[model samples]
Target: MPAPSFMGIYPADSVQEVHSSLPLDPLGPGAADLLAGDVEFRLHYLLQEAKKFMVHGKRTTLMPEDIEHAMEALNIEPVIVPPRPLPQAPFLAVPVPSGTSGAQQQLYTVVDDEIDFATYLKEPLPPALANSAGVKWKAHWLAVEGVQPAIPENPAPSSRAGPSRLPAPTTGAASLRPSAKQHLTTELQLYFSRLTAALIPTLAQLPNLPGNSTPSAPQYSFPDAERHRLAALASVRSDAAVAGILAYLVRWVAESINKTLMGATGTIGCLVDVVEAILDNDVLFVEPYLHQFLGPLLSILLTVPLGPHPPPSGMTPTTIELRTRAADVLAKLVTLYANGYPGLVPRLLSTFKKALTSSPFPSPLGSDYPPAGRYEGAVLGIGACGAHAVREAIWGTNGDGLRSINDLIGLLYPGEGRRNKAPLVRATMRALQQLTTPKPEGATVPPPDSAEVAEVFGPHFVRAFEKRPWQAQELMRLRKGSNGDAAAVQADAAGEEDEEMEEVQA
Candidate 1:
């Protein structure tokens, strides 16, 4: 069939035909129109791509195989073609009743080959394998020094497909071998295909074939793709047999996160979910690749503005939600690996502190100031790393960082006191509360005088806990006996050590 003009916009009816062919309910006209637009765009893209393959092949005329090559390169499922073309069946014309009385019309239809059921039944019955319960089994060494021995339990080598026939990770047919590509099995390739089709589908659904996004984006998460995504996440979470592709999955998550963090793409809420799934999967051996996730997670948490330009109304909703979600995953990951990997908590705590307190060279607020959204994320990250981080990281030696934080909060909520001013102030106070003893919800612990609260935890805490005396009292009781300025110097010494250690490790 000739390809449609890439610029031509399709109507809902065209998209409906695709649904009808697949046994799915016809899409709503609105959705169909949107899909039609996307389909037209892909068709245009596919034609341009096919021309490249045609040029490379030095052919002026496009071949069926050239189109197939373009589809495969775009991650589309290429249509398999037979090596030898079959002869076409001749069309038969039969007389059919026309508009009126004696007039007749001829209708053309293919005369398909018919079979005799009686003869087919009498000829033979195909053999069937026994059920699992009925089958006999025996165990043997399938391979000794990487060679499978042919036996009653094993298939003959001649009948089995080998590594040379299997698709390589790259385009390396010659370089791929059983020994060299031990883990790159057919199963792994299938797993990758399905997983990519589920999570990042835009490319897979190219030319409007079965597929999302550049793997299909629901403006293309077609119902089936959404289900596939959930099932894939569940498999990664609970399946114990996927070690061969664990590294690949890790890189996939990091890459998705980078694309969004670097502003090259949009929110990867699914990748955040993937990270959480992997972190929750206790069965997986993830320690080796644990560091791979940190860079991307931190980038999401601390990258300023999160996009090319800040919205006039301030941080966008998507940006806020992503930062919040990334912070939670970072916390779970850091807490999980903290004990085995010493200095993990403190290192992250230091990093968050720098973002929270230090402004870069071209700061609008000043060199001492940082972006408000990033600072808020820093507080959330520090809280996630560990609650104890507030003492050494936030309070600082003699409360220097806390002083800067208090000034920022005061500037944000000018003339405000006696209540939580904003989410940032709330987050900072909550981190401080972590260092205090827990008070029951019903218990009424009288707060310290405003002067004393400011003296102990700095003025920011005073602003944060002004009305909530329970939180204020907790900080007062815990910090009363501690030497304030002197112990801060000691904590500063420890904070410096964490900084130096993180630098060395990096």
Candidate 2:
């Protein structure tokens, strides 16, 4: 498939059939007209497919076939588009010569400044974002700025109260403002609480799928519950809901890490605990009710700092705890990702880096898998955040570092003098396994060929999976365990064998 000379722009749905090219062309002429003419047809197809992208600023990549399909959809022939290889923009796009002239630096800075200024000026955020509970999660920051925090007050503030006596306006309102810690707490609390309620329908739908079926194979059920979780998370701005969600995620991580079977029961328990904690309360999660709340809590911690913005100062303690808890949490998340949640590793790495190097948090202990005791916990959480970017080559968001992670996992496991923290390693491995395997009951399994997969798993994924012949074999075994009919047949075979033995005895 030939790459388009220019970036393409089509009505988002126009690119539904696009697999390997830029979905929308920005540099081409008459792009808007092209979109307008084919808008209805493209929209019709998109709606039929229930395609969801773009709402997240996702650029749709297309392939030759996708471009052809899109052109055909519009009753136009696919153009024999020639590849005009424009210099691919560098990730950081530094100038070739270091210490360029002041004029050059100013020119570069002006461009950046203009882009930021325009983005800042764009008002009234996407409705999906604005309507999300995330607004409440970080609303506490509003308190820091001395603004009336945005939140759904438990008693619901009365509209009849006229504006209170006003103070003179501050210039800070003109710029990007930092939110207060207390307000962040209140907002996050309210947001997750609401998310818990919203996920009920999806949660109710999980028990319906045959528990033992490969997601790719024909299945009697779909993961409505998992879908709800993803959708609920998606509905939020990545940053806004992160803090609140992290609060719950850590608990899930802690529980699963400590579990025995390290399978559905433990994983599901963690998920349930997380969902319930967010839904059921407005307070600190501590035991009986707390019983291994750390997993979900840690998950939240690892994610929030890596979210759209940095955590508020108040949430620094939470961030610190996660950093203390990170070596283990990170190892577990990586394993979980390897097992099935491979897509999540990239996200986790991003968060982990943020928590390690960012403004507020301290660095992690030198080694991975810090000690599990309380005092060790105190120093474990330091300096884990800062904007240390992973080398894009080593770990592209597309699951590139699996082999490295696999090595790391080995180091974390029992023996190797790291056995004292074996539980963390075990739980981390279980999480990885769960992530790599097909999601269990009610888990939403994304389409292997979907854009989401492509972004995380890379374009040539099936081939990549085939490359790891041994891992592929294990995946096959896991698939059988997850298959309903196969298990039934195995059960029947065992029963028949038992009966024949009985007959021989008689």
Candidate 3:
């Protein structure tokens, strides 16, 4: 029977031809259509089964083995077909060219010969080649006498031929070296003694002498011995005795603060130098003694009248300068140890508030209290803490911080026509500027925007400045200008200032 045709897929003539080849009975009417559909369905089923086998072997393309495996899995017996011999074609021969060399002819003949893998495997391996000459090795002195030969083993001639003249000490010698503790202690004591003597004003000099009779106050000097001591201390790498030495130094400074304030500018400067030297020493970490050192350092920074009070002014220029120095030191300490001492920023903010908020004590003469150096120090200290610390400390969870900032801002104008507060006002303004300005380098987070500042202090900012007309100018100055305008203005002002100075000189 003949099979029906699928549209373009299977032709009716081909199916009829195939059916006629098979030795079967005559076809029924619908037999061809049923047979064609059944053959198509069976082919699709076989292909799907073969694909499963292909995937199981982790292959993309289908192989003959996959079809065989699919037939086995589906319980379908594969049809076995006898292999047929391939037909062979007669070889055609060509005559060699008359100009060809014998060597080239031999190469062509070798290529035409049939290769037998079994015969080649049966052949014995070839013998090794004989050595052409006897082996020899010779040695020679790399260095002749004192001068070394310019060989690969030796360094370049420009480099040192031997070890340096002053060779580093060996472990044995280093172990025998004497401890520097005792020497450092002696030097520190001597330096502090000299510093104290120079800083403390004598009773004879205490009473202001008429005219120039009162000789110039003694200047604080760093002697060679003191410098050597500081160098030794800085060189000491061991942290073992550092705590004790730091404590002793802190004690000396604390004791001298009172006497030094009696016109001991030189002593204060010397003390500041010592503190800076200690801070600069990488080997000595003062984290452990931070609390102990903070008290004395803050005393220097926030002391009311740094110099003698009986003088014309409560705070002299030297005293103000010392206060500024102390403030700088305090700021450095806070920056380095703030994380270790979590409460440090809060404590500093508190001290700043107290300095600005406390009413001035009545003087002996009943005159209005003069502005103290402590106010300046407090303002500088707050400014040095950086913007983030300033913001967090002043506007943290507690509302008191913002209140303090407001009080400080209020003190900028202090009513009743008193203008002696210019220094305090300037310091406060600087601190405020520091708080608002974004750090140009090494800042991890962007500074707070004007909106954030307004959100924090907006409610009280206007009210705080409303009563004080003088503060309006300061408030206006504190407001940040647009980036482009500020930059242009700064450049123009600098150029104009330079030109004016040059014209005046001419």
Worst 10 residues of 1 by lDDT: 166-175
Worst 10 residues of 3 by lDDT: 168-177
- Candidate 1 structure quality by residue, lDDT tens digits, 1-506: 33332335666678778788886864653566666766776687788879988998999999877777666554355333434354677999999997768799999999988899889868743322222123355689889899887776788876677433322122112323333244367776677656655654342232232231333333544455466667888888888865656766776677666655534222355677788988888789887677788888888777765743433233233565677788889878977888987657866877887787665334443434335667778887887877667777775554455677777776555564434346677667766666767777688766569887677556666656777787766655555545565578799999999999999999
Task: Choose 1 or 2, whichever is better by TM-score.
Answer: 1
Report the C-alpha lDDT of model 3 over 354-446, residue by residue, as the tens digit. Answer: 765576544444445544566667766677676665544443333245455555544544564435545555554455554343434653432
Angstrom error at residue 325, model 2: 14
Q: Taking the tens digit of each residue's C-alpha lDDT, what string does model 2 give over 271-379?
A: 4334443433334322222224334434443332221122233322232233334444334334333344323444444444343332322224433443232212211
TM-score of every candidate relative to the true structure: 0.50, 0.20, 0.39
CA shift of 445, model 2, Å: 27
Residue 356 of model 3, lDDT score: 51
Q: Which pairs in model 3 have colliding backbones?
A: 4-32
RMSD of each: 26.2, 25.3, 36.9
TM-score of 3: 0.39
> Which regions of candidate 2 are displaced past 4 Å?
1-349, 352-403, 406-415, 434-506
lDDT of 2 at 347: 46
**Superior by lDDT: candidate 1 or candidate 2:** 1
